[model samples]
Target: MTKTDQSSAIPLDTTARLPAVTYVLTFCIAVIGSNSLVLGPIAPEVARSLGTSVALVMSASAAFGLGTAASALLMARHVDRLGARRMLLGALLGLAAALALSALAPAVPALALTQLAAGVASGIALPAIYAGAAAVAPPGRESRTIGVVLTGWTLSMVAGVSLSALVADLVHWRAVYAVVALLAFGAFATLKTSRYRDAPAAGSAPWPLAALRIGGVKPLLVACAAFMSAFYGIYGYLGDHLHSALGEPVSANGIVALVYGIGFGAAALLDGVVDRLGARRVMPFAFLAVAAVYLGFALAGGSFAFVLVITFLWGLSNHFGLNVLIMRLAAIDPARRGTIMGLNSAVTYLAVFAGTTGFGPLYASQGFEMAALAALVLMLVAAAAGSWRLPASATPRN
Candidate 1:
């Protein structure tokens, strides 16, 4: 085992169980997370409403990613001392305001700005949410707790994206944003009104670069970036692609996205899937599975049914793989969990930024088929990096 993996090994101890109220923190996560994928379900309508092309409208998507990258890079170190409750509340409030602003945006530029604000809020909130889950977890249950909380993101895909798309089809796209605004407000209220307690963090700050210097750390980071780039690159364009390729309605796109979410949530919550089979065993296959699915989607023609199946399978495999990756990173340094996780978040969204921006024009020219092919190349790299570099010990339960 590499030194970092050795360093990251967690012990089962008699730690306190997480309080029931802490689950509110998870809802807060779902609301904030909706901001990231909101554009995916409604991009075409957003483009038409703003008098822009889907490619240009994607700039708003890029802006959200950039905003996330900026905040994560600048402020990740201080998250522990800042307190999870404080950061999460602040970010949720900002997200509510930003979503409301998006509802009223006059043009693509205005919309992009609003999304930028929303992205920054998400970038700040997510790491804190993960850290908070760990802080309150009962030792050995930390992984399960973090996984449950991540169900927030999964729910955002299923409930938030699908429901918003349904709402958008019924009304205007702006109404979708309005509903998100209301929900964000409701999430904030739940957190604020709950019997919340501030989880304590270590007195010392996280040094991400220090962890990065470890033998396996750099490879894992690369693997993370590559994985997200491949996954999100296609995901960012899935709805628009479906619309243009098959003349499918937004509701169809929402259904497919919900299926994808179902796959992810199901895999993440599967009983003893990770523990029995182990993450090391699953990770490589997941990496290859996502790549193959993307390639299949690229070649599958405009059959929405085919696309839906591929999308669902990709989500199932990819979410399982990502959970393994995240567990490894989270275990890298317990004292600096917040900082490491924050860096992980930055890596993820920035890769989303790169993939979304990089593939927008590619999708415009050679189509989503070529775009998926491009993402496949990155996924292959992720597979290799993760397979070869992450030590066996990285999977603790194994």
Candidate 2:
């Protein structure tokens, strides 16, 4: 093992078991979710408010996603030297400013710029938070803690999108950004009072100059990309699908988002399920569930409630499997947690961007059923590939 790996190794000790680390994880994940939901349902309204086109308003999401992808891959190397707490604080400050700017943006390009800034901040925050979790958690509890932290992001997506949509409907869309800024401010305050400290700098590994060469890292990145591609393909256009196909209102779609969020939260709580059932087994099953959900969605015949339930199940399985993979990566290279996580984030966001941008025209031209069918096939293929690539040796046990 590398020196940094030895240093990052957690003992089953009391200090590592403190709750403050959990608080930090929760706060950070919430920020991710809120940032994710800032667009979509509100895009049209934002466009109208800014005197621009919906397409232009939606481009902000793409810009943000691009920032996320680029920052994760490029910034992974410097996280150790920067310190997790300092990195997180800097990210938060940048995000806060971006939110404020986006909320008050007078033009489409300016809004996009602010969104990109927020995305960059979030990209940095993600690796830091993951590294911190690995640094602080007790041995064997990495998966569970990672699950809890990631659940915060899922919850934010569910609540943030739905709530922001509702708030935007009642008031101005700009108020949504303002609210996010305020929530982030509150989270920053909470983190300030917590006793969580940065990982010790001694024996820390310098950032890898090349791409990840560790066991499981490459395949893990591929799975991350594929999984997120399927995820974003469906979710990025879920609102339009609901309205255009099922004739559901924006508010109703928000409610559906809440249901999906519940599923993610439920799955995170079941992190131990991965430990008990084994990562290899649980991951393939989760991917299969996503495929099944997509199939159900394709055949739902526009049944709003049925589709909502399908989405919920999809969220549950996707989160469960993804968290298991994250835990595996952390275990394989504990010293390079930030770099590994950053790579994962980069791949995932790249997939998301592709799904969002590439799938749109296809969906618009082919209709929801065809789009859903394509996503289903892609997910199933991803599941098969993941199962095949993952060796039997890596399977986890309760």
Candidate 3:
């Protein structure tokens, strides 16, 4: 274990509890998840509006995911140079611009470009926010604080997907983008005036260059990539499956989103429980459980209630891998925080791109069952690799 002098490292006065910081960071996570959910629910409608196939509309999400992943390496350099607050504000502003552009997009490519821009913003801002949380979090409560922060993602997914689906049903698909634009602008303005500290500068090469030199980081990065590939593969194209399998194109999106949100939120809340029970012991089983859920997803579309239960389990296990991995990384040398998190975001988003982009075509042509099976295979691979890669030190006690 590593220890740092809190007096020298942490930025704000160590007097009052960091109230708004947590709130603001959680809000940011919510914003990121909101973007994903918004696109998911309205995917088919957006496809029709753009005069394109659902596969093509889905590629916008792929573009966003790929852009976010690819941009993380570059954004780390900027975050190092400009500081977290500045970078965050800029990203938020950029996201608002992107959302506005997406809403008014005259063509699919233009919409994809906007989503790509949003992806860049999301890539940079999210890890920076997580870094902030680690810096300010009260002692002995890091896992719980992180879990609390992730709950925003759950809320956003639930609220964004369900509401956006309803809006798409009642109004138009474009309305979802318009609402996101306003929310991004609002979040940006709120965060602009807030006080937050940038991490102490480590004199190092850019994240990508530095990552090339570091060997220990590779295993963790690979594990994260594998984990996220499976995670996003299932969640990203779920709306499409809801339409194809259940034949509930309009309302199914909202219901599926609700199911996932409840599951994710409940699982996140259970992080404390996992902590008490031991993360290692709980996490392995969660992975296996989630793989089984994927199997269920393969078989689920026959019944609405069955889909709900399966989606819940999927959400629950998704966090187990992520939360545990983060806790492990936080225990690594603090100087490497930026690079570690940058790669984490990079690989995860790469998986997102792969899963969302790759599986959509597969799901469209081959059908939902095969796509679901593919997700299961990916998760099983992840579980096996993760079991091997997890640092013994990071393993939770049974």
Highest TM-score: give the candidate number: 2
- Model 1 vs. true fold: TM: 0.82
lDDT of 2 by residue, 289-374 (tens): 88888888888838887887787887787787678667655656555677787887888889987887778988899887877887
If scored against the real structure, what TM-score would every candidate get?
Answer: 0.82, 0.87, 0.82
Error of 3 at 84 (Å): 2.8
Off by over 4 Å in 3: 1-18, 43-55, 80-82, 168-174, 212-216, 236-250, 274-283, 298-302, 357-374, 389-398
Q: What is candidate 3's lDDT per residue for 58-135, written digit by digit as tens? A: 778878877888787767556555556777788888888898898899888998999999999888887676666665
Residue pairs clashing, model 3: none
**All candidates: CA RMSD in angstroms?**
4.3, 4.0, 4.9
lDDT of candidate 3 at residue 373, scale 0 to 100: 88
Weakest ten-residue segment in model 2 by summed lDDT: 1-10
Number of the candidate with higher lDDT, 2 or 3: 2
For each candidate, what is the lDDT? 0.75, 0.74, 0.71
Tell me the number of clashing residue pairs for each predicted model: 0, 2, 0
TM-score, prediction 3: 0.82
Once fitted onto the true fold, the runs of candidate 2 whose alpha carbons sit more than 4 angstroms away are 1-18, 169-171, 200-209, 388-398
Q: Candidate 3 local accuracy as lDDT?
A: 0.71
Report the Cα lDDT for residue 68, model 1.
83
Displacement of the residue 348 alpha carbon in candidate 1, Å: 1.2
